[model samples]
Target: MKKSLNELKELAKICRGDIIKMTTVAKSGHPGGSMSSIDMYLSVFNLANIDPKNPYDYKRDRVVISHGHTSPGVYSALSRLGFLNPDEVIAGFRHSGSIFEGHITRGIPGIEWTTGNLGQGLSAGVGMALASKITGNNYHVFVLHSDGEAPKGQIAEARRTAKKENLNNLTVLVDYNDIQISGRARDVLYVDLFKEYESAGWNIIEVDGHDFEQLFNAIEEAKNYKLGPTVIIAKTIIGKGVSFMENRHEYHGAPLNDVEADKALKELGVENDIEKYKEMRKTLPLLRKKLEFDDYVITADAGTPITYTKEDKVDNRGAFGNAIADLAKINKGKIVAVDCDLKPSVKLGKFEKVSPETYVQIGIQEHNAATIAGAMSVCGVIPFFADFGVFGLDETFNQQRLNDINHTNLKTAVTHCGIDIGEDGKTHHEINYIGIVRSFFDTKLIVPADPNQTDRAVRYAASTLGNVVIAMGRSKIPVILDENGNPYFGETYEFEYGKMDILRKGEKLTILTHGSVAYKAVKVADKLKKEGINISVINVSAPLEFDASRISEYIDNSHIIIYEDHNKYNGLMVEFSKSVVENRLSPLSVENLGIDNYSPSGNNENLFKIFGLDEDSLYEKIKEKINK
Candidate 1:
């Protein structure tokens, strides 16, 4: 039997109580926003055609929480719906080893995407909706957003894209709960979200977020609409249930103590809350069944491999494109490539020729491309997005950050990384791609040394189950390993996260580098060897989380010279120094050879020489430092 409005409201109240109690016990979480959005959450979970028993089922509708700070509310609703055990929800908030983190995680069963970075969920939702349309699936994607976060530029960009594309399967719900972390949202950034969305070609609906019937009706209406996306502005009060906490900024992220918890429970007519919680646990299994776990597999038809000749020296970007085409031959149905109008330069045009239907030519919209990739990932497809490293990383860092938070498993192939992208000037050069991506723990940064490694990295990224940022260079590098050679080939060197590959062994100086700069280091080491200076060269591919223990033995035996195609401040220089210090490796004297300052417009040779990143410059630097 369908649940009545009163029953839904009662359930929403129960959820609010659970949220407050959980956050109070954890002593840290956003309570106000959670409380305000309880009714809206209850309405959707109750009315949407979502199956908890088959959470990953392809036919199931998707719900993306944009206002991720209100994780308490989402956890409460998911718990009440039986997606997780009530005890797990109560015991796991901000706890170590608990999947129920302060923010949403992909570990949670029913969550379509992990989110916390604001203003990104809508874009991701658009992608999911687009995927549904492309694949002929009849599922709707609903994105819940906070009012204050709507003013971000990406939000506008996403809205414009949705409108232009006529995405009717997408719906955006704005929790117009006046208050944010500081004060009223309007006071901080006045936004007529209803009018803004309407002007952008979205069908706007305003409703009392606390009203279950109204919210349910709006959702039903949205599903029936066939023109464009819908935006439901849900006007709600911050901290709706608790009298003292209502409409207050202080309660946004504070945990109530025992005494306050008692008072809050008393207001809800649940004087003996322990008994109530015990009884609710019995009904938790019903909610768990709604989270489905059916995995759908799509196979691609076989196609001829576009083999490259030995004489043709191509850039990593070109090799990545060819690799994508190879992937399309293997998994055509579930693999797609998106490019930001730089398809010709990024070499994604090759994939487009092979799989025209699977390639999306999103012109000059890196932000849109990322969200599209996120959406496609959610729909059981692998998306490789390509662009220049500077535009792809720095310009759309927030989009990728949110993708990581969402755990979208989107693979980004960023070309022209670091000062090696010469003559384009400093504005076009990307020397900080690794550092920026490394800052986020969820993202894996892969800097392949050569074309073969680039192919391997692309294939690995396509099959991996998390968000990835593959940094590639514009220049063509010589193949370091022979095609028949097996350098650590059989011994499980399969792109383990945080593991480094030792290319050459020597007892003198240790040359640590990655990407394009690592090649220069190898040349420099060979030059030094001719003059009786045998330097060990290590290709440290995984930048974010390096294996200190595996490389600790080598650090003590040699003086380390870290070379990179990036700035010295927060790039590889600092990372190497910190690693040595933390491991307490005999206080080794390390010399950093990298682009220490802004670069100028010049050829690749001039730029590398000026920054001391080329073989000649690096050789001189190492010689001078060692001689002294």
Candidate 2:
């Protein structure tokens, strides 16, 4: 059943035709790169240890295409290898109702990680390779990337990690075709791939990618490499087969027309079948097979949710570190934390000390770390990617966005969120975590008010499935107190997703806040209580998912004041406003209070005062508005 050299060469020709036919029918896609990388695909699919029949085999090799725009090539090669139907792919490439999306998507039988954004695929492959080491599996991970994406900083980060971990099970095939969407890849951006890979301590294998023998031999040798990861820097043409298209940048993304397709098909000795696929595209099912996701979920022994008493003052991140450490201690391989050199800042010091192996220290590589954590999280490990909110969310937004699309079970915990991370200036202060996480439909955002809630939330996230972002501030704060001065999120409180904790109840107005500001809201409510200015304080831990129905009574009569340390135009205020209109609930008056502009570098207290986010500011603002 294995493909011989002659058979592979012939199959390669047919696959080239398939790629062209599919792209021509769709009137879009990267046929040039696909054609360039086709031999590598066939080589991996044929010579590699993978079963098309049992595509998701546990020990089967993972094929990750980093430059996913070459999806036409991937689909065609997989179809030839029996992973997908040839005709379906030809008609459905980038179709509105097809699984053959513009970029390669996971859950499509042969695809491992869904990738479109460059520089992430190598990290994803490194993650799978790391998992193999951790789980003691012999499976190898193969990532096919383009030379154009070699300049991505995250790829450099991934290279360092692959070397540091000594991941011999990982092999990368770079389609060094030298041409990109622009002119020559070197002209657009010069990346010395050989030097870089060698510097990263990678075993570099140079080969003519079009030669089946060289490709297969290189891949086999890469598998036999004992030192560390191998990079098969396949020197190739931009368009390998078609004479006119070869090394041409215009053909990179543009699909050939009918006349050009006819000429190309004739050159490859394949039939001009564009019209056939175009007709088939009309009758193809409105919806293809629904994506089969990785059903692996981590069930941690979510030990007793620790309750911080009113007397104990702690930062939410410190509590998170404690709780995550407890989880890592109890559950060995079931839980892991991916750190980007911010162990002390993110308070992952405890987890690292308790379970060192469980702590993945990929330094200063937030994009790669985010992606790697996402990959590992899907592979039966609950990976908590901890970092500053700015680095964790803002810098690595696209990586997280892909993770959302993949629907990975990742816990992205960020400290130094909002103006609370003062003196670091606007750059370090991540004031829009709520806004960023709101974009992720699958990811739930939790801004825990205090140490107790942080502990409970971390525990909850560990037990639960799907993506979650636990956003917190840097500064330490008092434990949020109930009406009787007892801890609000205390012994009896089970951290629920959408439910809000009413710290104190008042008749005149309600102040909605979370994270470091929740305890401050409690103080404001308590202050107002003495002067007969009874104001309610509600701690909205989960800003993304709020059951307005549960708090309808609080907002119906009381003037609602939204307070936080986030962008006023794009944070909890906007979410709450949308919720009010959607739920058709009426509050006396709605006012949004938060950072509308960037504050200067100083202590958080001064920053808060400058932004009018201090306890006194909220108290006075409430009095002035409600009294009117």
Candidate 3:
């Protein structure tokens, strides 16, 4: 039976009460947007074909809360729907150890995508809808936005793409509360969302966000129409239920004190009903279980195991493509791989050969490729995007950052990193890829030293959690470890994040490098041994958050020379220099050798020599610097 308008209003009131109590207890949260969007959230979740019990159900509709600052509202709805206990949900809001973080996280089961940053959810939702259409799945994607977030260009980009593609299964709900943190949204930035979205070819609907009946009717109407995507602009007050706080900008992110919580609960008619709420919390797990069983009926089994012979020598990018192709053999429909017109370059040709239906050639559109990957990740299909490091990081840095913000489990394989791309000239050489990617806190940058590590890293990244960027070099080096011959022992090489590997130990100077430069440093160290200079070489693959203790131990014993195939300003050299100074390790003279300025077009060897990165140049520079 469909819930009545009054009942939905009552649920929204209950949700607002919970939002106040939870944020107050946590002592921090966005209450204004939470209260304002409570009715819209209640209306959508109540009517959507989502199985709270089976949060991971394949066929269930997906909801992505783009305006993640309003996590209080999302948490409230999840709590009422039986996905979380009221107390646990309340306790975890902004708490250190709790999964109920300040923003929505993957730790919460029913939350489709973790989000905090605005303007990212719409792109992710578009990807999900696209994946469902491509895979022949009957699932709809719903994304909630803030009127204040309209200023971000990605949102407009996503809207245009959805319209062009005619993604009718996608629905976007804008919480037009007309207020940002500072003041009125109009004062901050005036955006006519209705006209903008309509002009972009979206079917637009405007309604009172607090009116549950009107919201439900619009959603139903959108579901019935199948021509293009729909945007439901929900006009609402900043803080709805709490009279003292309603429509106030100050309450946007302020936490209520004890007296305020009491007053808010009193207004909601649930002042002394803690016990009743606890009882309601106890029924949620069961409700979720029932919902899961009903909605997530279609199960895609793990497909056949892939067998590869050890005779073939494949590039890491090629190996990644091959592995994905193998995964497609089993679960063909559920997996989709997108490339930015660099399929042949990234070796996605293997996957394209086997499962052409699952491979999307986005045609050199790096931004579109990233947005598509974000969308595909949310739809439950593991999407791996491949492109050159310069294009992936330098070109689409914002898109990837948004992917991280949305917490989409998107796997990005960036190849042709560093000067190893060699003959392609300085334009194709990308040495600062690691530093740029490492800047994002939520992203994991995996630089595989060899093909075996690359294969393992790619496989693990595909199966693992959260957003990951796997970097691969252009040069084909030796296989450091044999995974096929000794799979168990090979796994022990241990890919613990932020850890460095000691390649060679010497007493004179520490040569810290990563990617292709590390291999060059190893060769240089071997040659320098003949000249009686024992230099230690460390392959610092995990550059973002390196194990300081391990690095300090190496630095304590020897003078440091950090070599990278990137610029010296913000690359590995700068980070190493900063780490040494910050940790106050043993006083050691540090010299950085890398591309000093903008590189000019030249052959790889000539460029390396010109940049003082060649083995001979490095040997002479180190010998001269060390002797002094």
TM-score of each: 0.82, 0.97, 0.74
lDDT of 3 by residue, 201-266 (tens): 999999999888799999999887789999999999998877999889999999888778788889
Top TM-score prediction, candidate number: 2
What TM-score does candidate 1 get on C-alpha atoms? 0.82
lDDT of 2 by residue, 1-628 (tens): 6788889999999999998898899888999999999999999878767887787777677778899999988998899988899998998999877999999998888888888898899999998888777766578999999999999998999999999999999999999999988799899989999999999999999999999999989989999999999999999988789999998999999999999999999999998878888888999777777776445456678888788887887898999999999998778877888998888888888888888887899988889999999988766678999999999999989999999998888999999999898999988989889889888879999999999999999999999989999999988888877787788788998998988888887786888888888888888878878988788888899988876778988988779889988899988888788888888998989889899988789988988899899988988898898779
- lDDT-superior candidate, 1 or 2: 2
Score residue 47 of candidate 3 by CA lDDT.
Answer: 77
Candidate 2 accuracy as lDDT: 0.89
Minimal lDDT window, size 10, model 2: 290-299
For 116-170, candidate 1 gives per-residue lDDT tens digits of: 8777778788788878876778788888999989888778878988887788888
Error of 2 at 260 (Å): 1.7
For residue 69, what is the lDDT in candidate 2?
A: 93
**Strongest candidate by lDDT:** 2
